[model samples]
Target: MTRTESLANRLQEVLLNGRWIANTNYKHQLEDITWEQAIKKVGSLNTIAALTYHVNYYLAGILNVFRGGELEIRDRYSFDLPPICSKEDWDNLVDEFLTNSEAFVLEVSKLPDHKLDMPFVDEKYGTYLRNLEGVIEHCYYHLGQISFLKKLIFA
Candidate 1:
C-alpha cells in the first residue's frame, strides 16, 4: 500500500477501530465510560474527557488545514474542554471526537502520496508524513494515559 494509505490506516487504528497496535482504540476505551468516570481525577494526570478533547482538538485543527484552511490549534488550549456536567455532555464530546477522527482519516487517505513529503503548513513543522505520524503517535500516547486512568478509576 502507499505510504499515505498506511498512515491513514494507522491513524484509524489508534483513533477509531483497529487493534493491531495498542489492543485498544479510542472508540473502544471511551464508549462505555460515564461522564463522571470520564472526569474522575486519577492523581495528577489529565481526565479522560480532557484527553479526548485534546486529541480531537489537534485532529480537527489539522483536518481543517487539510481542507485548505489555516492551522489554528494551540497546545495551551488543547485540554480546555468545557465541563462535561452530564452524560449528554460526555456523549457529545465522544461523538465529536469520533466524527473528527473519521474525517482526519479520510483526509489522510485522500492525500496524494507525493504530498506526504510536502511541508505541512510550514517547513519548521516538517513534512506531511511527519505531522501525520506525529498525530498517530500523539493519539497512542494519550490513549495509553486514558487506558491507565481507566484502570486507576476502577481499581
Candidate 2:
C-alpha cells in the first residue's frame, strides 16, 4: 500500500477501530466510560476526558491545516478541555473526537504519496509523513495513559 494509505490505516488503528497495535482503540476505550469516570482523577494523572480532548485538539488543528488552513494549535492549550459536567458533555467531546478522527483519516488518505515527503505546514515541522506519524504516535501515547487511567479509576 502507499505510504499515505498506510498512515491512514495506522491512524484508524489508534483512534477508531483497528486493534493490532495497542489491542485497544480510542473508540473502544471511551465508548463505555461515563462522564464521572471520564473526569475521575487517578492520583495526579490527567483525567480520561482531558486526554481525550487533548488528542482530539491536535487532530482537529492539524486536520485544519490539511484542509488548507494555517497551523494554529499550541501545546499549552492542548488539555484545556471545558468542564464535562454531564453525560451529554462527555458524549459531545467524544463525538467531536470521533468526527475529527474520521476527517483526519480521510484527509490523509486523500494525499498523494509524493506529498508525504514534502514539508508539512513548514520545514521546521518536518514532512507530511513526519507530522502524520507524530499524530499516530501522540495518540498512542495518550491512549496508553487513558487505558491506564481507566484501570486505576475502575480499580
Candidate 3:
C-alpha cells in the first residue's frame, strides 16, 4: 500500500477500531455508554457527549470537503453538542460518528499522496497532510479524555 493508504488505515484504527494506543479505539471506548453517563461532567470537564460531537464535527466537515463540498464548519461550534437526555439522541450521535468516520476513512483512502502536499482549502489553512494528521492526533488526545471520563463516570 502507498503511504497515504497507510495513513488512512491508521486514521481508521484511531477513529473506529484496531489496536492503537491503550489497545482500544474511540468506538469501543464509547460502547455501552448510557445517555446519563455521556452527559455527566466530571468536575469542570466537558461531557463525553460533547467531546464525541466535537471530534465528529471535524470529521464530517472534512468528509464534505472530500465530496467537493465546502468546509463551512467553524471552530466556535465544534463543541456544540445536541442534547443527549434521551436514548435516541445518544444513539443518533453515535450512529453519526460511526457513519462519518467510516466515510472519512474511505474518502481519505482515495486521495493520492501528492494531494497531501497541496493546499487543503487555502494556502493559509495548510496542506491536507497536515490537517488530516492533525485530526488523527486530535482524536487520540480526546480519546484519552473519553476513557478517563468513562472510568470516572461509570465507575
lDDT for model 3, on a 0 to 1 scale? 0.91
Candidate 2: stretches off by over 4 Å: none
- Give one digit per residue, the lDDT tens place, for model 2 in 82-151: 9999999999999999999999999999999999999988899999999888888999999999999988
Clashes of each: 0, 0, 0
* lDDT (Cα atoms) of all candidates against the true structure: 0.93, 0.93, 0.91
Model 1, 16-116: lDDT tens per residue? 89999999999999988999999998778899999999999999999899999999999989989999999999999999999999999999999999999
What is candidate 3's lDDT per residue for 1-155, written digit by digit as tens?
98689888988899888775668888898878998899988999999999999999999999999999998999999998877879899999999999999999999999999999999999999999999889989989999899899889877
TM-score of each: 0.98, 0.98, 0.97
Clashing pairs for predicted structure model 1, backbone only: none
What does each candidate score in C-alpha RMSD? Answer: 0.7, 0.7, 0.8
